[model samples]
Structures are given as structure tokens and as C-alpha cells.
Target: MRRGAGIGAIRNREMVQAKYKEKGAEMAETQMATLSRQLAQLRTSLESFAAKHGTKIKNDPEFRGQFQAMCSSIGVDPIAYSRGCWSEALGLGEFYYHLGVRIIEVCMTNQKRTGGILPLNELVAQLNATKSSYASEISTDDVQRSIKKLRCLGTGFMLIHLAGGRTLVQSVPGEMSMDKTSVLGLAETHSGQTTMSLCCQEFGWSEDRARTALNQLVQEGMSWVDDADPTGERVYWFPSLFQAVRSSG
Candidate 1:
């Protein structure tokens, strides 16, 4: 009788465990269903929003940047698959893809002068000046979006943030040394040009140390030497910084 009781207790325990497992599975399924519904609702709302502001988002750089930010917040890539629900709704995918192509052309065209690194605004300006059918509508945001797509082509397009709120689009594959980067930052702070004396005064570096870093940048074609300074001091002008100055002027 004791043996039979023990067997019955084991059966009861197994039954309870099986029931709990089944309940957990059902709960998981229900949660998944709720999440799916939420996602569907989000997509529908996003599509409606995109459709409503499609033109403004496409033609205006500021508006487009804001829209991209919104899409990013929701984990939506409007241009992810070229042509899909989001693209069909907003027509942004085709716009950015074409812009991406034009960006490659511009980068290749100016590679000699800029060494695959140029001011983001200047790049946009050149792209708009290309007289391409969509050139008139191109903006900095558009250029940035297109460059994001160009990463797939292994083109090494990247955005660099320099001092003084300057941005550059880099299409080359190279790492800037710390000293070079610091020099660029210093130049950015000084209207895109840095004199050895300024560097020495600011960083307390010896004349030789300051000259070596600035000279390295000039050697890499990343900076231009300006011996025409009224102060009779050679100044290193970072091209991207110069580009920013020109645009602002």
C-alpha cells in the first residue's frame, strides 16, 4: 500500500509540473501576440506620418533630419530595404539611393583635391551644383543619408566631428593620429588656421613638438601651409576647417 502511495505522489508531482509548463507557454504566446499588435500599430502610424510629410521631408534638410531622428527613435529604418512599406510610403529610399550614387561620383571627382575628406556642407554644395535632376533638392541631411548607404559598397564613407561644430565627410580609410587630431582641433578653434606660437602657448608644447604635428598634417595633404600670414608666422590651415569657414562666410 505504501509503494502504491509513493507512486501516486510521484504522478501528482509530474502532473503539476506539466500543467505549470503549459501555462508558461500560453503566457509567452499571449505576450508575443500583444507585442506583434503593438508593432503593427507602430508601423501603420509611421507610414501615415511619412505619407503626410513626404515632400517637406524630402525637400527640406532640417525637416528631413528631424524626420530621420523620429524614425530612429522608433527603431525603424525607412531606407533599410530600398523598396518596402516605409519606402513606398515616404519615397525616401529611392531619393537617398540616387543621392548615394551621386555622392560617389562627387567623391571620386574631388578625391584629388580633398583626399576623400571634405566639409559636409561643401560636399552637399558640390552635389547640388552637379546639375543632376535631383540636385536642386539635395541637402546636408540627404548627403549624410546617402553616405550611410554607401557603406555597403565598402567605400569607407564616414562622418567626422571636428571642433567648433564642424562636420566632415570622410571617404578614405585612415586613422588620424592623436597629435594630428589635436592639431586639427586647435586649428578649428582658431578660424581653421594655427600658428606654431599659438599651439605652443595653448598646449605648452615646445616649438619642435608643435611644428612636427602641424607639419605631419601638411605632409598628408590634410592641411595647407599659409606663409602669407601678416604675422610672418606660417599657419597650418585644415582644409575641412577652412571649408567650414568659407561656408559660414
Candidate 2:
């Protein structure tokens, strides 16, 4: 009879512990839901802030430096903050998120130019130009660091090198201009199906830069990923341009 009583006591204790664990799990789930909602609110706020100040931030070297400095002051990595906020709550791929931000910035640059994105070459030119003057203020290391962080956040940028010593940089969808002729003419000739690495080698661009640019192009729909290559190299062949050419022809 005593053994049976002891067994009953053990079973009661187990039931109590199980109840506590179930309550704890419920509390945890509630907290996670609240946190997720808060994160979404934060991302909306950041996106508004970016829309209001992205161009200024991109163009003014001093301002960009000061902004980075300010991020340092607050003990925060601004790029990481921006990217993290998007990734955690939104379930967006980093490349798409970054590309989306870039597209919005381009749209904000001109409302009428909406839907007519800038070409990869022009975008790269702008980035390089900004980098040139901003180089002294912001090191290549910083840019590379930011790039790495952005990639982690799932955002990617592309850098294109063309013949005659020109480099073009652009983000995806937000800035792919349909009207301009790519200096490489690969986009014009191949119908947006050419590999970026091949274009870079043909144009003598740094392999790393070319790869990044090609990836961006693929994301933006200016180019397509080469299924033939197991490694997933991107090729641009003027898919947009060909459509236009077909219409004209």
C-alpha cells in the first residue's frame, strides 16, 4: 500500500511538471509573435526613412561618411540592422530585399521614370563615381565589408566591366534601364541569355566584379542564369532589347 502511494505521488509530480512546461511553451510562443510584429513595424519605418533619404545618402560623400560614423556612434552596424530587419520578419531573400530597396530608390529618383529602370552600366558608373570621391572618406574595405554584409542579408549588387576601360554597376529591377545600349552589346545581341563571366572575360573585367554584376543582372531580369553551366553563371542577352527589336522588326 505504501509503494502504491509513493507511485501515485510521483505521477502527480510528473503531471505538475508537464503542466508548467506547457505553460512555458505557450508564453514563449506568445513572446515570439509579439517580437515578430514589432520587427515588421520597424522594417516599415526603415523603408520610409530610406525612401526619404536614400539618394542624399548615396550621393553626398560627407553625408554618407557621417551616416556611417553615426551608425558607429550608436554601437550599431547600420547595414546589418537594415538587412536583418528585412530578413527576420519578411522572409525575403537577401538579394531580392536589397534589389527591392535599390529599385525603390531608383523609382524615388524619378516618379515618371517609374518602371524604366537604369541600365547596369549606368548604375555601376554612378556607384564608381560616388566611390571615387567617397573613396578617401570610405575605404574599399568598408565597401567590401558592406557588400559582404548585404550579401548575408540576401541583397546583392553587380559590377560590370566593359571594353575601353569602363565599369558599370547596377542593382536589380529598380535600375535596369531598357532603352540604353549596353557598351558590350552582349545584351543587345544575345537576347538576355549570355553569361556574365563570358561577357567579363570578353570585355577584360575583373572576374569578381563581373560575377557580382552578372548576378545582379540575373536578379533584375536584364539577364538569365545559364542552365547549361552547373555553376549557375549569369548571361545577359537583351531580353528586353530583343523584345523591342522584335516589335520594331
Top candidate by lDDT: 1
Q: Tens digits of per-residue lDDT for model 2 on 1-249?
A: 999999999999999999999999999999999988877675566556555665555555456556556445535455546464333432223423443454436424532321233344343333455434533233332343343454455444444343334333333325433222242356555543456566565667676766666666455444534566566653445443444446546
Alpha-carbon deviation at 135 in model 2, angstroms: 11
Pull out the clashing pairs in model 1.
none
- RMSD of each predicted structure: 4.9, 14.8
How accurate locally is residue 43 in candidate 1, as Cα lDDT from 0 to 100? 71
- Report the lDDT tens digits of candidate 1 across residue range 52-106: 8777776777888888887787688787745444666667777777788778788
Model 1, CA-based lDDT: 0.77
> After aligning candidate 1 to the native by TM-score, how far in Å is the CA of 89 from where it should be?
4.1
Question: Per-residue lDDT for 35 in model 2?
Answer: 86
In each prediction, how many residue pairs overlap at the backbone (N, C-alpha, C within less than 3 A)? 0, 24
Q: Please, what is the TM-score per model?
A: 0.70, 0.33
Name model 2 segments beyond 4 Å from true.
61-142, 146-249
Best model per TM-score = 1
